[model samples]
Target: MQVDSDPDWSALLIRVRDHEDKAAFALLFRHFAPRIKAFLRKSGASDTLAEECAQEVMATVWHKAHLFDPSRASVATWVFTIARNRRIDALRKARRPEPEDLPWGPEAEPEQSEALELRQETARLGEALRQLPEKQRALIERAYFGDLSHTEIADETGLPLGTIKSRIRLALERLRHQMS
Candidate 1:
């Protein structure tokens, strides 16, 4: 059996800087892909989309790692920023205008386009929201998605009002942590 080596980010980064080290790229991909996927999923991407985003992010790392500045951000932060940008691009891709088989007036068309964009963005956000535990996720979905008030959520879910508030607060905290 082959032993897996621990990631040596600084050394791997040096190799990446040389522009010839596929091994370094491999090592970096191995270590960071899961985190990227988790981040995207928390941000509201589905599993498949998050996986694709992770791949795109790593590909970017391979190309742009040479430009990386450790002084600006840690390796984790750098890799995740790449992941975040790629995720935004992927969300944008999903929000393209649909071909109108027939013209439905400019007014209707713009509204439809905006709705599609909102749906794509909401899905991405929901995916991230879903990464939270059932309690936290439910709190968020009820408050925002279902338009429930804190009292309403507490009543509907049979959770204490304080518990509902706390869960929502914690979920936002977790999301903020993952994002930055």
Candidate 2:
């Protein structure tokens, strides 16, 4: 009897992609589905959501099989990346307010005193931001106002990821002190 200790996952995936082989897809699903569910659960999804997302991710794998490039990523890496992106999408969808939750009429404007207070606070924040060292201030602006992730900031600045995080943290601390 030939032992099937290590089946070639890449070959199976290629079969699914090129030939649309049901047997190969079955093998891939059997191997990856449960692991994907467990990963989603560990990433803070409830059991039901994890199971649903896992199913959807596997379906995605089947549908998007042709897009998978073995040279760029292993089969496991591609599947897990799909799962992670699905989780992020699900979280974003869940956080969005429903249409019914939105106010219907024109929103009321703030009172003059409240608007003045907000302007003063904004000015104070601007001054505090300016007080930070230029390097730290730039990082803060990229991370907050620019809406860039630390990794993206690192890539753009050609700095190490740890340095980006540390500068952002120190800048936040200084801003807090100034605001208080």
Candidate 3:
């Protein structure tokens, strides 16, 4: 019997779940890596950084392929979202002493996950983040999550300092607009 070719990405993910399927992995990597690179570039990553970030995203996909769920999002969307979150994480690492990460003795504040609905609300927040123009989203993610100062951000990103602030200001305004 002849085998069908160019199966859906969801099916490719199923193949990736098989422990020995290196070919499935290569196919998945080839398809998604360019999209990841384009995504990072649009989100204001320099070319070199975009390339490096795409590699990381694909590495993640290879490792996490078992976790792929068609119900959550299309394979492409899942991959891009991972890249987006990674970019934000890279852009905005914590600064100074984080309240939670503080090495306080035994009295540290206990942590808990947000409830299911609240987590969905935060997912809505993510969708809202995606709605903002790419530049605005990138700036806000970098500032809020990466905790970079305006000066440091500008120097690292090569964006004019004023543009950075404006994009962040606009992104926040958009978030409030969408959330309320």
Compare the candidates by lDDT and give the number of the best one. 2
| Two-way lDDT contest, 1 vs 2, winner | 2
Once fitted onto the true fold, the runs of candidate 3 whose alpha carbons sit more than 4 angstroms away are: 1-6, 94-180
Per-residue lDDT of candidate 2, residues 88-148 (tens digit): 6875554333245345335453344543344455456767888899999988766643335
Give residue 127's error in model 1 in angstroms: 27
Shift of residue 64 alpha carbon in model 1, Å: 0.8
For model 1, the superposed segments whose C-alpha errors exceed 4 Å read: 1-6, 92-180
> Candidate 1 lDDT, tens digit per residue, 36-114?
8877776668899889888888888877876664434446556756765675577655433435545335452234445
Residue-by-residue lDDT tens digits, candidate 3, 102-159 = 3445633222232223334445676788789988877776764343678889999999
On lDDT, who's better, 2 or 3?
2
Taking all chains together, each candidate's TM-score versus the true structure is 0.48, 0.50, 0.48
Error of 1 at 79 (Å): 0.7
Error of 3 at 30 (Å): 1.7
As a whole number from 0 to 100, the lDDT of residue 44 in candidate 2 is 62
Clashes of each: 5, 0, 3
Worst 10 residues of 3 by lDDT: 107-116
lDDT of each: 0.67, 0.75, 0.70
